[model samples]
Target: MNLDFPTVMLIAAVITGMIWALDAWLWAPARREVAARKTASGGVSKADLKELNKEPVLVEYARSFFPIIIIVLVLRSFLVEPFRIPSGSMIPTLMVGDFILVNKFVYGIRLPVINKKIIDMGKPQRGDVAVFRYPKDPSVDYIKRVVGLPGDRIGYFNKTIYVNGKPVPQEIIGPYFQDEHPLSQSAELRIERLGNGEHQIVVEPGASLVEGQYIVPEGHYFMMGDNRDRSNDSRFWGVVPEENLVGKAFMVWMSWQWDQGGVIWDRIGESIQ
Candidate 1:
């Protein structure tokens, strides 16, 4: 089974809080009164009473960690959440081992795990880099740029993108090169400008994905990786449901170089477009 740390933290917080609340509201007060009565009646020894009312080890640990766990849960569920990039689908924009902070409430405030948005905060726009629960397998999380909004016709052919029968502007910048790539050695790079959001993308000369024309379904968003030739995204699967939306990736707090030593300090603290 996949170990979901967020869910574990939430469960721990609830269990610990429950035990502590019960003690504070009912059990602790009753125990203190019983102990006092016993002492007055000379029925129980002081040492015995103290030991009897002592908390269990599990409860003690829980009480110590409950506050921290709840704080994290609340912050991640409603405000922001941290995620580590594990793949190179979002190359140039995001890298493997990149620790990014996603704005949780940008799209909307959703219940964690179930991911049902209760608030109508805002809608996603074109060129937004969004993290979401993968439509093919909701258990997995995927990150991609929003290419097509609801009701727009999206098409990918001849290594170019089209929306609503109009071609999305692209300007070739030449071959993409990196010291050490997590996915590929090299690819052609370009700048794609969709409205005010302009971002870099890379495509292989003879490479192709599940490229085809698709009419974006209502309440769904078409997603694509910056590494166009290699991405396994909406092109291969399907549109991401609005309910599956997680958050918009806003910044990179840290980036690590696994093949080499230490961090890629330059990429750290960079704003994600």
Candidate 2:
């Protein structure tokens, strides 16, 4: 089953908070009053009074966990959230097993679970590494570089990108090869300048890929993976709606190489472009 984590957390926080409040407002007071009456009548020992005032195990647990759950929910929903890169779609920029921090409020502030935007803070900019719900499947989160904003024309032809009839500048940085990554060894590393910033992109020479001009609709964005040909992006599916945006990925807090079975220490603390 596709578990909705945000919804689960919200539910847990509500249940725990209610239980704690109810116990304090109703149950605990009733217990103390009964204990006081018993002691005044000399019908209860100290041990009996203590037992009567004791809280239920469920209430105690609720009190302990309520604070923690509420904090996590608030931070994750409005501030920042951690995400694990699960695919090589963003390869060189964001590797598989890389744990990244996404700035939740960069694009806007949205409510938890339902993700309804309540405040406008900023908009996604071109060249930003973004995490968003997949247009084809909203249940899954996909990370990609913002290649085209709303109403912008994006073109991909022969491993090169064209923005508004102008070929985007690309400087070949020579061949890219990872000792443990056999599939990426043949790809060419290049610096592609998009918008006002530049980031590295990997493209296979002579590799056939989906090439065409795409016009981004209003309130939608075109996204592309840095791993050019290997990524499933707007070229294949469609533009990501503004509501599907999750956050802007800003840093790689941890990286684990599954194939090598070791931590990639160098990638840790690396800032995402």
Candidate 3:
């Protein structure tokens, strides 16, 4: 089953909080009163009175878990959240098994589970690496680079990108090799300047090219992966709506390519470009 983590967390928090609150408001007070009456009557033993005064296991567990769940939910929803990279669509910039940290509030503070934006903090830039809910499938999360802002014309022809009729410049670096894909070997490394910043992208010269132009709609953004030819992005599906945005990926906390090696120590704590 595809379980929604945020929803699960929210439900758990609510249940625990309610249980704790109920015990404090009604059950605990009733238990204390019973204990006082027993002490005054002097018929009940001290051990029995102590047992009667003790809290139920469920309430105790609820009290212990409520605060921790709330803290985690707040941190994940409004502060920062961790995500694992499952594919190489962002090759040369992000690896296949990189665990990245996304700044949740950078885009805006959204309500958990429902993901409705409650505060407007900022919008995405052209060159930003963003994580968002897939437009076609809202349950699936996708990460890609912002290529076109709202109302901008974006075109991809001959492996070059044109933004608003101006060509985005690219400088060839060298031949690129991916350890994960040993069978495919026609990729090259290049530095692409999208807006104000530059990032490395992997382009396959021999791969079949799908060229097209698009005008970004208002309240929507065009996204393309750094692995230009290999990525399944806006070119294949559609632009990401403003409401689908999750956050901007800022850093890689851990990297582990299990098929190649165990842990990639060098990639740890590296900031995402």
Q: State, as a TM-score between 0 and 1, how close model 2 is to the true structure.
A: 0.97
Which parts of model 2 have CA positions greater than 4 angstroms off? none
Runs in model 3 lying further than 4 Å from the true structure: none
Better of 1 and 2 by lDDT: 2
**Tens-digit lDDT track of model 2 for 1-273:** 666888999989999999999999999999999988888899687788889999999999999999999999999999999999998889789888899999999999999988999999999999999999998889999999999999998999989899889999999999987776545456899999998999998898867789899999999999999999899999999999999999999999999986777898999999999
Model 1 RMSD in Å is: 2.4
Model 1 lDDT at residue 269:
93
The lDDT of each candidate is: 0.86, 0.92, 0.93
Ranked by TM-score, the better of candidates 1 and 3 is 3
Put the candidates in TM-score order, highest first.
3, 2, 1
Question: 1-273, model 3: which lDDT tens digit per residue?
Answer: 676988999999999999999999999999999899888988898789889989999999999999999999999999999999998899889988999999999998999998999999999999999999999999999999999999999999999999999999999998898557542577889999888989999998988978999999999999999999889999999899999999999999999987867899999999988
- Which candidate achieves the best lDDT against the true structure? 3
Q: RMSD, each candidate, Å?
A: 2.4, 1.3, 1.3
